[model samples]
Target: MCLNKITLYLLLFCSCINESYSANISEDGSFQLNGYGMVAGDFQSEYNRPKNMTLHADPTGPNQDPRGKMGDLGNSFWHDYYTSLAVTKKWTGIGAPEQWADYTYQVVGYGDKALETAQNYGRFGGLNFLPDESNIWAGRRYLDERINVFAYNTKEVHIDSGIGYSSKNFDFAVGTAQIDWSSSGAPMAAEGSRRIFDLTYRLGLTEWGITYVKELDNPLGTGVQQATSFSAKYTMPNYLGLIKGQSSLQIQYGKGVIAQYLNTSRISVLSEKGDSSVRFTVDGSISQFEDFTVNPAFIYEYTKRDKSADRTTVIPDLAYSGGDMIYGYENETGIFGGVTVKQNLHHQNISMLYEFIVNNTRNKNGVAGANGNAYKISVGPALQLDVLPYIAPLASLTLTYAGGDREVTLLPKASEWRVGYRMEVWF
Candidate 1:
């Protein structure tokens, strides 16, 4: 790993000159290095939907995200693989008695069938310091660390360049990004900027957060195109109040720009007026037994958007109304419920895993025969290195059934089979 010692040292000096700084990231000064990513290959017998789902007629589903479908949601080989490598250095007991400073840089990337097609394109780096009782940070960072579910990371957070301050239990941050997005993810000029601000407070076992988004310049001529997001979450460290596990419940809502909860980076783009979304999630993991464990999650989401129809003007005969017509708002409602059951089949090192998901997303305005619902089940045996910290290799065979409305698959029901190999880890 390449180290930017100069940058880290310069920022470490920041709090020492101030004298009032007091915080310790760790017991002593240390150099910390960590990274996480996934490598996976998936194959399907026939062509099918994209890696994520596009709920019909809905502005968005799963927290107002057209990309509601994720994890193993028909993700092809090309779409299922990515990696992130990060490095961090913390300086403690170096200056001002007890001062903390952190420098981190992470690079995310994607690959193709050939090695040469791979590109490490995303860059997230930042400088963080605790000056006095407040924590100050800047640079492109993962804003909201709280996630609805660990499997798919469904939540709202800005992954852009910004600065933030946190003191006591109150936190505030503002970030800006380009309206247009590219794979490279390089920031653009602020001519037409997508700006975001977030404020959050943690009280006891619950967290309350709100986010506001605005477009500084809109090429579509939509004035004050904006969106807002709010969420209330409660977290419990133990399962059933006694077992060894963790669980959380979250309720979320978004309007205008429509919250892209599934999006890990980049601000959500402009949306048609009157777009709104709502979501509820419960996620938990139980490791009550040494040889058996389970992770379960349930999600319900709804989104609404208004469609427009231009009035017929050139031909007077078809004109029902002299002014433009509003086609009324369309709504989408869906539930994503699933569970992953893990059982150790070997000498407690080899595990058999079963993951099942039921999806039912609908469009109120779609044709009578149209709906987006699927049932998927994936089972695999995993081999984890006992000496290592994570599950290294897990290959699975997946069966997916798409059946809801006849219009969805042009038939009463459709089924597809897939084989996949994946190794995911974060340490």
Candidate 2:
């Protein structure tokens, strides 16, 4: 039965594509196609040494012996390709407006199909429903608007769709998604499904601007969850010559029942089982200085089980631009970087950056100190190239050394080095 359904869907998709192409050829002179391709490879290694400690050491450890040394290595590679084609027409005879229509299709294939270990390699096409003020009827009324929707369907289709009125700042959207482990050749206890309703309101309060969003989610075989967020920004009046640019402050806070599937199994043991928890997040940014900006944020998360435990974090980031040596630094209490620097390049559009990161965390037992505490120092050189017509290339190389207490049975002191390179092309 599943095979029959799949065959029917594929046949329908091909028929629609052929019909659309034929109609475009009859209405327009020609069509254009464009796309890009990329391939990447990644390699990782881990070295761990345990110490003689408790009897039932780490279950995740390679061996039952807590005082043992182990090493692991893994590598993966993947490729992605995408293409888009569009047909356009010009109005000449009757009283008609110029119009254009496009249909894009993309597919990605991979060698390893494992959900956690497999590499992603496809470009999902977006839906664009407006070119020259076209109209479509949803239920009964004629809806004349612009619509854009994008989704990723590797495991389950995660969709984000919305319709805009163009003249007014009001929009509404509904989305549904399902995750099937069978697609990835994996066993599943039960299939997961999610449905969401989103409403956005944008209002112009005199000179200030305000935006509000309400999101509600309903999961299959589960209860409903909802969240509300609001943000407002106002530009202060420039009375004197103290401030040059606009200074604005924004705040957002949301509290709701977090979806059980959204939690990671590695983070919480109860994540695999059906468990409920309340979560809240409050964060904001402030632009007070003309050339300098400061952003401080905090988060407190708690989960309930047989016992309740909570974790809190604070981060402060400072950045300064329009200077000889641009400085940017961020510190996440004790766990992340405390300082960083960017030295200007000589004669070229290149720069070098140096950063220091410290991570510290404490467990509920208050023993073994913090599980994921470490210190990392990173230095990298970045180059920005504007080679030809409307094309720019950015390349960077970074090297980091992470050292600190490791999670071993008894002696947990290990250090490692990592080197990475990144390149991007934009047009």
lDDT of 2 by residue, 321-387 (tens): 1011111111111112233444555526676755554434333112323355545566777677634
How many Å off is the CA of 176 in candidate 2? 0.5
What residue pairs are clashing in model 2? 335-358, 335-359, 335-360, 361-370
- Which residue ranges in model 2 land beyond 4 Å of their true spot? 1-43, 46-157, 160-168, 180-191, 203-343, 355-372, 387-391, 403-413
TM-score of each: 0.71, 0.44
C-alpha positional error of residue 59 in candidate 2 after TM-score superposition, expressed in Å: 18
Lowest lDDT 10-mer window, candidate 1?
1-10
Measured with C-alpha atoms, the lDDT of residue 301 in candidate 2 is 26
Error in Å for residue 305 of model 1:
1.7
